[model samples]
Target: MDHQIQRGTVVLATPWGVAAIFSGVGSQYAGMATRLHQRYAIVRETFTEASDVLGFDVAELCTEPSARERLNLQTESQLALLTTSVAMHRAFERQTAGPAVTHAAGHSLGEYSALCVAGALPFAAALRLVRHRGEAIADVAARLDGGMMWVIGLDTGTVEHLCRLWTEQDVHPVHLSIVDAPRRAAVSGRTADLHSAAGEFEARGAQVFPLRVTGPFHSPLMGPAADQLADFLTGIDLAPPRLPVISGVDARPHPGGPAGARLLADQLVSPVRWHAVQQRLAAEGVGASLEMGPGRVLTFLSAGTRGHPRPWPVDRYEDFDALARAMRLGADDEPAVLDACLRIAVSTPTRRQDTDVAGHYRRLEETRRARKPGAVATGLGALDALLAAKGISARERRGHLAAATGGRTWQ
Candidate 1:
């Protein structure tokens, strides 16, 4: 393929590149550099008590070292992560020309960033929430001594089965916290339990790595944190979202209803269905995805699902010219066709509700109908073949289709 041709499909093809910019946190770092004069205002202003307890300077954790260094401390790490992602989203708005953010979703603390992006909460309020969250985790980490770990190349089923066996063998019952893919899952619990689980997984042909989190997040152990955070979040005034935001706990699209913020607080103690988030986005026809922050973590999380073109890692590059080249899309060309296809698939009906699948089919049929006779024959023939693959009889539909094609018979 020509480097300029981009490596993917147009509408029904895999997305070649993301048009919209999804970002958070990095902008905050830039703003903090000028605004705070290296004071670390967000953490110092919000997490006063937690900062006092940790003895380490929260400001230094957030602004003194590099962005990657801030990520080392769970509290500062998550806060900076959320703030930076929000900043990136803003930067994207300044840079891109498109509809407002269609929908948003974040992993763990990134949920706050999503909400901020959607305008459900203010920047300062979100910072406070993160501060409290960090304090709660730091408190728990100090007392209970727990941590989080990532396991690669194992499906949830296998991980759950292994965890059960580990529990039977006197190891703690670690909870599956984040399911990023069919093969990648993160678990959380006491450090000892995690260590023992790592040993057991290593024995079973799996790789386990520890995360830089202070507490056993998204587990029963975090119940106390959730309860406290719930009180704080619920008491605050959280406006409805201006844009769509996905729920990390359920992998469902949150409608910015009354319960949105409450659910966010509850997320602290619930498993993050990250796998579902990416799958749902792909299913819904998101052609191109952009990972906003420093690392390619979200894009990495989305690797297994179909529809989305490989996610574009956007950083360092000042503009999207490189990305557009990579995706093989021109400024004038409609966004990738695969993105449209994904939208069609995702918007398609389900047993619980009527999806727009019929609409998609109608649109495709119309486009084929409008094509030249020769082209219609080829397209209908392809549709017939696809129907056959699904064991559906297209004979009856084929006749009507042939008549519509003006005797341009396929076969």
Candidate 2:
């Protein structure tokens, strides 16, 4: 574990490989997204765009240590985590020339963030949805007096047994909320139940670490919140995903549309198939994946997962080049550059457009603008500085630009 925490360079294979991206709650703190903000225009722009939707200075909140700490408050924490994950991905996409990843998934609140990034869900609307979700979860936890604990060094079967024993004890029963690895599981229930189970779990030589979370999330205890979330999403519009996104619930390619919404809603009361999702990604041909967010949690879980060569943590500017090297950039490797890190899904006939047609059309217009020539103009700000060193002929530049953007104007 100590060695895993240390910094080092990665040795990459010649052909490069596909990557899967995942992020979840926890591992958030003060100034989590500030590093990318300092170095990448995409990160800065992402926060700014979210800020407009949220009606608060999200960028300021994330970069300011004091405010960032307070951001851990229920609803604030969920939004902050999502914003940071999106910022990291956008920064990563801006620097890379082609598809960086072929698959993606987000755990719990992270799934909503994934949906927003995948273009299946709009950024502003996702924020509104998750904000409501976070609040509902917090409310349920308050009403039910919920709590959670992490039991390490125990398989899922053993953890389930322990949970059953406690639930039978009839003092605030807990259930598996997250199964992250072969020996890692989180049991959630009432606060007292979690506290009582600690001794027995530890007595059996397992490491019991209670979470500083607000609810027994992803367990049956979250049934109320799940129902509320389901109803809340009924009026929202969702589109088909462009690139495939794995579901945290079933560990399969999410069937985008209303069905996807149900899966997300059920995630509130179901154990997140964390370990299974990674294995599934490997099974599906992703040779590698990057923890494109504030922490190395997912990267740590990738160890020993089949077909996955281990993931890299792209949490800082230094990580960019290392990830680039891993992707075999500039090698004989074809740029399988992922489409936009976050793109709207293809129109689905089953999708019900939001009632606000004007706003919906405006968002559609933005999507169209994004596909036009030089749409990524702002993201290329850094590289623009380097172009001054040499002058290529207008004709040659136009030809190259035409090839890349389907004959669209360069500027």
Candidate 3:
């Protein structure tokens, strides 16, 4: 007879997907997904009266790699976002001390998940609420010509001042979106405004670029969506949270119950106070920070400033055991902040003393002329930065014209 042991180290020469599934952040996601699916089957069955109307295949969409593709559809995206976050919150709570949570918050769609975890709304109710929100908000973004832009190397006050100045001078208003870092802010509005702002920032030596979202989110343009969402939520039952959760709208702890529901609905139109959320979390002495789903975007955005100027730590399932072990050692003994900083710092690009500024700009001109959007924009921006560092003016770059759109220049 053979004896089996789990939760113990087993050495292997090769890294497998199973290992990813069992380790750190990956394991949390897997556990959350599983927990949600089980509840989804039971809950969805109750609400879905007809097979044709409720035709979404949860097991297939969630389990398949192509699930994210389905999320591109507004309805599906909302559902998946809600389900994944809520499930993760539930799973995480069970694993950690339930009373250890002093404050809770989420970024954008993740806010609903936070509320669910905090007990302001039930998981099923939150899912249904977000579905309606996704549909309403997506419809508005499609109609608007506005979008978002990332502004790096500028203070938030400076960015806001520039936006006001730009709008006053006939350039559309730069809707300051989220303050992700000390020098990083996301601005939203018309595409023309964004392009103009990007050009201005580049002229002033800041790295500005577009994000891959379809519509202008977190601006006044989302007001209609907020209204509709509010109407929908008005009919739903809400309860006081088991714990306090911070609001991205104002960065204050929500009062829970009906107030929480209203804030969740209003979040569609409000700017996310991600910077404030991070500050609050740190002030509360939260030693470990975990991004509940998908990309490391949230983790990067929420990292502490008191540390060596890097981003947040990540505890994906692969590091779950380590995180668990660390948490057991208590907050004062936690390694999350240091771990997060190490992860980001090690990945930062190292600048060489002999790097070429002019030649780099020339290459960017060629790439932009070739019409690969991301490569063109990012490449050109980096080229511009290098050139500026070498004291090269934008106008003096002869091939800069090559980077211009053919009779359809960006700015």
Candidate number with the higher lDDT (2 or 3): 2
**Model 3 over residues 189-299: C-alpha lDDT tens digits?**
888878877888888878988987778788777889888988898788777766657678887887865777788777776677777776665444343455555446565
Q: Rank the candidates by lDDT, best first.
A: 2, 1, 3
User: In terms of lDDT, which candidate is stronger, 1 or 2?
Assistant: 2
- Tens digits of per-residue lDDT for model 1 on 47-117? 34334545554445555545545566666666656655565566556544422345577777777777777
Better of 1 and 3 by lDDT: 1
From the highest TM-score down, the ranking of the candidates is 2, 1, 3
Angstrom error at residue 146, model 2: 2.3
Best prediction by TM-score: 2
lDDT of 1: 0.57
Tell me, by lDDT, which candidate is best: 2
At residue 336, candidate 1 shows an lDDT of 28
TM-score, one value per model? 0.65, 0.72, 0.64
The better-scoring model by TM-score among 1 and 2 is: 2
- Alpha-carbon local distance difference test for all models: 0.57, 0.65, 0.55
Deviation (Å) of 6 in candidate 2: 36
* lDDT minimum window of 10 residues, candidate 1: 402-411
Model 2 poorest 10 in a row by lDDT: 333-342
